[model samples]
Target: MDFILLSILKTAIAAPVLLGTLAYLVWIERKVLAHVQLRIGPSRVGPHGLLQPIADAIKLLTKEDFIPSYVNKFYYWLAPWLALMFAVTAISVIPVGPVVEVFGIKTNMGQADISIGLLLILGLTGMGVYGIALAGWSSNNKYSLLGGLRSSAQMIAYELPMAMAIASPLLIVNTLNLREIVNAQAGYTFGIVPNWNVLGGGLQIFSFIIYLICAFAETNRIPFDLPEAENELVSGYNTEYSSMKFAAFFMAEYCNIITACSVATTLFLGGWHPIIPNELGGQFLPTLICMFFAGVLFYHALNPSRPSDRLSMGVIGAVILGLGLMFQVPVVKDLAQPLFWFASKAGFLIFFFIWVRGTVPRFRYDQLMRFAWLFLFPAALLNLLVTAFIVAVKSN
Candidate 1:
């Protein structure tokens, strides 16, 4: 009963937060891309356009939920939800922090702690292809059908390299459990360099790079986004989708980006572990970062450009400052420090995803397939073989 209740409680917290993050991720992407093109993104929706996501959500929800007569209505209705469900479900096994006691209840920050967490993620992501394929085929449009086929083929081709890259780290860690993989990367060498998989464990830097490239391909992000190339496919599989269905597909894509980054963080970047050892005051870094942001907010508020910023920025800044101060308290620090580190690392990776979208051009379909098979797959396999050989020699 207790376990069930705790699980429910965690789900209640995680679900809403995940949805909100997905919405804001869109805003982040727009703002980033706009800046890259020398434009001010969304400034009118709210102070600094912080409320733009809420406005977008309302718009999507109220828009016409139109279904074409020629389309297979059932699968058209089912596909987006299916994509969103699997994308969000994969996060259950990703640990945000170490096990901690909250109000005398011992629990991990993540939802599930399954032994085969890595495999679970792989399976869920593999299943996600069905959603795109079904959406395309059911639409009864040539463009959508082609997009779906491309997506399916792309995922299949990339999974081999991604799996091999993922396996290289597992070879060094010797565990399928996500948390154990993270734990193995904890601590540092000579009290300076982190023992993260990329840096220390099997020195799998090339593996990490390959994994990231494969991740970009798997999530259908640019440079590898042939499946949804607007120029060629006319918005691809979900071109016929509108309103909340479209939003659901959008949400699924961002959720997958988050999941990919989180998995990478856990496998190679040291999930929740400080960049430096805790004894070296790494725990205080979060508080310092928050304080810096608070100071910047207050500075902008003092010379407010917009009328709303004078009040909104001031209040937000004060709240952030207060949170930063609270981190100085022992109990708060113990609870929040891990979360701060994990979020920081994951957030940077998410930003990287957006950055690449703004900077890179989509690859031609043939080029994408060829790169995956000829280059990424071979590189990943070589990295895995080398990592395994090193582990074997060390064990002996």
Candidate 2:
């Protein structure tokens, strides 16, 4: 494909895919959280709450766009849009898969193939803080301002650890390009263990762990979500916003979660590489898993606990079975395998975030800040130092 056309094609595909994912991600979280809490969630909106996001879109779009009389007009309006833009923008450089020829046109899976992908993403993530800070301050509400301040502090504290942890892998890969970082981790140790940053060959699990801890904070997720704690600040930094502006902040948070998970997949989880090598029949794993899940769904459909689920589960199962069979096609199999592995890994990380949210309680503002500076930062620094030492020794 022509470079410009491919770029446009990628953007066109990515934007809608992301928006759609953001919608369903909310449904996924709600359903998972409901199961965790021993409750049924959103059952009234479409089959199994599948259309809940559409309802949510309509509601948010129709809600009153009220601007507070006491607010700073321009910054208050800009904050959420700014938050959303930066959150979603970071994905352009992420390598979803290696370069491949699709339909006789060659291209990389990512929208961009920039040399400094890692650096650029890090910078973009750092800049996302401005939105929160501005939203709180511009609201002219005391609690909102405090919430913003806490977020700023939390981010600053965790960022050092995250950057240091990221550096450990950088030293091992010897490149700043995200694609190169992933490529460096291709293949395995003794044809058994995959060379992911968190696994045997790379052995940067400590750094990966540190990075995850910081990731939770950077994305303002559970246990580190002091800035948005309802009990503490009553909607936190975005308290004054209404309608789509509020929804923008809401969507931005999820976008950041997805972006953070994607980065984790790229940096430490081998991007789109299979957890098991193809020689061991890893290529067939996705199809098998998909079929297995479909079977489970079919089983549930036969003995469904909910009346609605009887039909919904069967329909869902049939769709998944169809997808599983499609993965067996020769050409689709090649391209599909890589995308499947990438989605599975990234999907697991995203699930982990939701799982944590349903189970973990928010941290005290003071405790959150202290934990980041006192523990995560020092641990990351040590991990980076040890990684550098090992890589240097191996070179010698």
Candidate 3:
């Protein structure tokens, strides 16, 4: 009973934070784009548009609800909430930081510390696709149908490399729990470099690249954002949705983006771990650096073509945060090292995602289908084979 109550309490707390973070992500996207396009975004709302997300929330809430006459009412009503539910559920398995003892009870940042964290995330993501597809089918419109089909196909295709990328870390740690993975990389070597998987056999770097690329596609971000291609599909699957219904869909999309980043941060980059000063500083360094890096990486990944301003802000923020960590005592200083490396590596991958988004053009339906089938599928297979061989050799 106590554990169940605690789980419920955690879920309640996480719900609001997840919703607010999604809104803030949208605001940051706009701000990053403004910098990319050489214009200021959301200046009128608070300092540098800090309150812009709140304003948008209010506007979305008050908007009149619209329901198309021909639409399947029940399915239409169920789709958005389904999407949000699956997206949020994926977060339960993500371990954001180390456990802290509070009031004789230990609390971890994640909702749960399940061993099959990777599989659970993948499962929820697959479920999210169904909600998107159902929304289109229920709408009974050509555009919505087309968007739904496109998203369904795209997600299936990307799931290949994404799964393979996640497998690399599992290969190294030989466990499914995210907390175990972090613990594995807690220490430093040569009194300097951290012992993260990112620095391990060439597999780590390759896995990181694959995971980050697939993440963009999985989240349906720009470049791979064909489902919601405002120019092509007019608003995509949720085209006919309005009021809270549309807001639910919008929130779902942003939540998926954050979930994607968080999962990637945990798998390849190391979640909530600082880059420098491991165990040297306590939560101070890890929190500041991790947040700054996360913000920068997300912005860069979302807007790679023009991220100079956003990148600059991120670096400055990271430095300031790193300084805070440096001030902590040596006992906990080493603890912050994973966070520092985590930020640096995660930021690089996020920037890489942005660069790919900017440099590469969208794939045609057939091309997208073929690339997934021919390239990513075979590559992932090869990665799995090679990983197995190396593990066998190391054991022998």
Candidate 4:
């Protein structure tokens, strides 16, 4: 009973946070796009558009909630919540940092800390694609149906590579638990460069690349976002939605992006590992430092300035620090620096997402399907096989 109650409480906390963050991510996406395109976005809202998400939420909430006359009302209503729920649920098992002591209980930051974290994530994400497919089919509209079909095919194809790319890290660490994986990568030689899986052998690097490409596809981001190709399919699967229902779909998209970023952060970058040199050590200091960097980088990505600024350099600094902290071997007591380090790495990835969004154009549905099926799928499979072979050899 206690365990069940605790789990429910954690979910309650996480759901709202994830939902709220998704709302802000929408704001962040628009803000970053505006800066990229040389325009001020949502400045009319509170304080340089800080309150824009809130305002938008108000508008969405108050708008007329409608179901198309011909649509299956139950499925249409059920689909958005289903998507949002699955997207949010995946984040629970992902550990944000070391076990945080809340009150008397020493609980981890995330909901679950299972050994096969990757498998859990994969299964949950796979199930989420159905929501889009159902929404389209139930809409009773041709465009929505087409959009749903596209989404199903795209997700299925991309998932192969994504899983393959994910396998490489498992080879190096030999474990599926996210926290253990992060712990394996902790520590440094000379107070610089964290020992992340990215530093592994050639096969690992290849796997990382495959993972990244697959990530963009999995999240339906640029160069792979065929599900809702705004220009061609006329808003795709969500063509029929309006008001808060539309907002649910919008929130789900950004939530998936955030989840993908979190997953990549865990696999390649070293989940929540702070970069401060623990050998040169402080206690909780490193963790705090890492957290700070993580938070800042996260903010910066959401709200970036022009490209010419030295933000990239700062991001690199944070990544290094985070790696140093998470990789600490002897277990650095003062973890204040890591807070900054962890955040920095996360921020860097977020920056990359923004950069990709701005620079790369969306893919056509056919091209997107071909890339996933022909290229990414094979690459991911090859990478996975190689990783497994190397791991077997090393063990022998």
Which predicted model would earn the best lDDT?
1
What is the C-alpha lDDT profile of model 4 across 268-321, one tens digit per residue?
Answer: 877766454545553445455556667676566556684422465356547755
**Model 3 C-alpha lDDT per residue in residues 310-329, reported as the tens digit of each score:** 55455555666556556365
Q: Candidate 2 on 267-286: residue-level lDDT in tens?
A: 89998999888899888888
Candidates arranged by TM-score, highest first = 2, 1, 4, 3
Query: lDDT for every model?
Result: 0.91, 0.90, 0.73, 0.75
The CA lDDT at 187 in model 1 is 84
TM-score against truth, every candidate: 0.97, 0.98, 0.82, 0.83
Best by TM-score: 2
Tell me the spans in candidate 1 whose CA falls farther than 4 Å from its real position.
305-308
C-alpha RMSD of each candidate structure in angstroms: 1.3, 1.0, 6.2, 6.4
* Counted clashes in each candidate structure: 0, 0, 24, 45
List the candidate numbers ranked by lDDT, top first.
1, 2, 4, 3
Candidate 4: segments with Cα more than 4 A from true spot: 102-104, 189-191, 200-203, 281-341
Cand. 2 TM to true fold: 0.98
